[model samples]
Target: MGGSGDLDAQLRAAMFAHLARVSAAHPDGVPSDVINSFRFADAPMRLIVQPGIRKPAQLDAALTIRTTWTPPGAAAPYADEVGPDGSLRYKWRGTDPNHPDNRALREAMRRQAPLAYFYPVARGVYQAIYPVYLVDEDQSAHEFGVDLGQYPNDEDDSAETPLDRRYTRRLTLQRLHQVLFRPKVLRAYESRCALCRLRHAPLLDAAHILPDHHPHGEPVVPNGLAMCKIHHAAYDADIIGIRPDRVVEVRQDILTEIDGPMLRHGLQEMHGAKMFLPRSGRDHPDPERLEERYVQFRAA
Candidate 1:
């Protein structure tokens, strides 16, 4: 048993390292092809197991959990939701708590073993969040409480004040929204900068047209624009702006500024150029939201 546990720890560490590299290369999500190719110690070990839970034959605890992606405008199949205490609620496989998969998860919770969570961002792709701990299991509710490395495994939830719990929940939701927002927006734009048309995925970001704190701001593809780092910074700082007509505008001062080639070509030369919008009309930016944000840039 001791040797088995040790091997499990080693295998988990290798899997974490492998996922880290894959995520760094593909910030959006891991494609099905890449996920299917994963191996450890020169042996066959599937990272993402089918049917959600993965319990390796050599290990007593579950090693990973997965959630399937639901198509846009479609109803979700699972009732998975965020708990009031800031934990993620993952539903059980079936009604039986004693089933192999459920028992593996319960054992993982008892052992306080860390597991990787494969969350789908799009069809046939997943964003990996690792070192997730199963803190609690409610058989009657047919769900398990999951912590996404935010709190220590042994932390007492009951000790938290109501205010603290609310704050934590808000933060958790915000993080989740941001995570899910980026890939969708980037995919809509084909992983290219809307302003400069840069095709580098790592250099691109999903810039929100209206700030997230704004009442009308929502984390949808229509409310976002994919941009390179410099352009994103310029957009946020009002150094450049996009009009409702999808034309780029450099701030008057920046347009006339005397600087190195970067400022000249990157910002000034981009003035009057039209943005590269998504191919799908439904994915286009909202004109009203753009006008509202343009007002801020004009004032600045």
Candidate 2:
């Protein structure tokens, strides 16, 4: 009881800390065991907060989760039952659902319900800001990752304008992509710049084929290419380009006027060379997206 109480206090503090950081509209900062930083635009009601092994409830989306209940010694309110999904359904130990403790649990599950899913940034630290409400009960399985909903409480009451909501969502999505997208791209490219073949992680970036502002643009691995810092900048600036067919191209004027080794070896000589690609076909940059962006490069 004491341990659980202490943990609950810690969880509250962490939630507050996360709320403070995200409400300010900043990206996630340093995370500690008590709380995680989230963006203001993140889903408010359907979040995940994990408290390690003892706390077997894992939140995936809003109400989606994998929760566990162990038999208390030998006594239970009823015999174990299985849910429609083949999940086991375990009743609370108490006879009355209205029991104070049970009511408290239900209310907490409703109020604090995961506003956001909290995942580990490190060993003990977890991010927990998305809002979530456990809407169902299932227990047969050990893994539960379910979708709660798009908005915090099935509505967009938080934002006054749809455009404003979109803007905030975009910003928050970018913040999430920073942590989740780049690493996948880096690994997909084996930490090497697709153009220069530079293997330095610090100098590499996950360049998007279609700019994020594009309606069709997505931050999936297939939409990313690993490139060195200079190459990334040049690609973004339309100085260097990749065709949908996977060929590297340099601006004709720059190719003609540049004379240094940096020009010759860096950008010019690479023209017509096949861009390095990921091992998995699924992870390769989308040809359609590349084509769309390549048009802009050609115009430039």
Candidate 3:
């Protein structure tokens, strides 16, 4: 109770600080509590407040209050993300490399941080990126609906309440970008590289299905091919090509001037192989992306 009292003092200070900053829409005759509550919902705490005092709304003036946003010292980590299938993980975000949030919490931070806060690599996908920040346990969160204890991904036998669409929006955006380049290319190839069977991440590269610089176009994922690096470069230079049905086609131009065991070993040998398949059914490359790239392949 004593601690809560202290929290109220801090919260009150924050609330009034903002109230002092702006003129209330209903300043005239509004009671101090109502004025205070409204201010709490505004600047310095733009909490989406409602009737229940549990959220951003201010509660009974006499009752000790606290914000739900965790600060640097929170027992719970600062960042949390929930997945499409309802998976969740938490992390402490911090700038310092030596801090626990930076070291121990890095993985969770990548998974759970905000879309604005998360670093973006695949254009719009925020699924796997985050900026590190120090853990300050003293801060408050007016967006208090998320119960750190209620985070589901466990055998708690409890169901989540009031489905928060915030997470859903983020994941969908991320998945959409992957659709642009990945699944379509993998599917076009029938899921295996034409040359080597490098079935792992570190080795695979999704190359343009057409020569990178086709007169007809701009780049799109469908214009891609899931080939290993060797094949990717060869395909880009028209040294290697594949028909829409996945049969490999080597350019006669390369055959005469570049006669060698290396070319023969990689390109000529792959003349009749099929394309690689998409990794996940959901990740199958876009047919249009393939079609766009295929046209470039024909011209080259």
Q: How do the predictions measure up, each by TM-score?
A: 0.90, 0.51, 0.37
Candidate order by TM-score, decreasing, is 1, 2, 3
lDDT minimum window of 10 residues, candidate 1: 148-157
lDDT of 1 by residue, 10-115 (tens): 9899889888888778877788668657687788788777678999898899999988788978887776788756657898988898999999999999988999
Candidate closest to the true structure, highest TM-score: 1
Which residue ranges in model 2 land beyond 4 Å of their true spot? Answer: 1-178
Query: What is candidate 1's CA lDDT for residue 207?
Result: 96
Estimate the lDDT of model 3: 0.41
Q: Which candidate is the best by lDDT?
A: 1
Better of 2 and 3 by TM-score: 2
Global lDDT of each candidate: 0.86, 0.57, 0.41
Name the better of 1 and 3 by TM-score: 1
| Model 3, span 171-267: residue lDDT tens | 4444434333443344334445635655543345667554445653334445555677788888777677666565577776665555678777777
Report lDDT (Cα) of residue 277, candidate 3: 54
* Model 3 residue 159 distance off true place after TM-score fit, in angstroms: 45
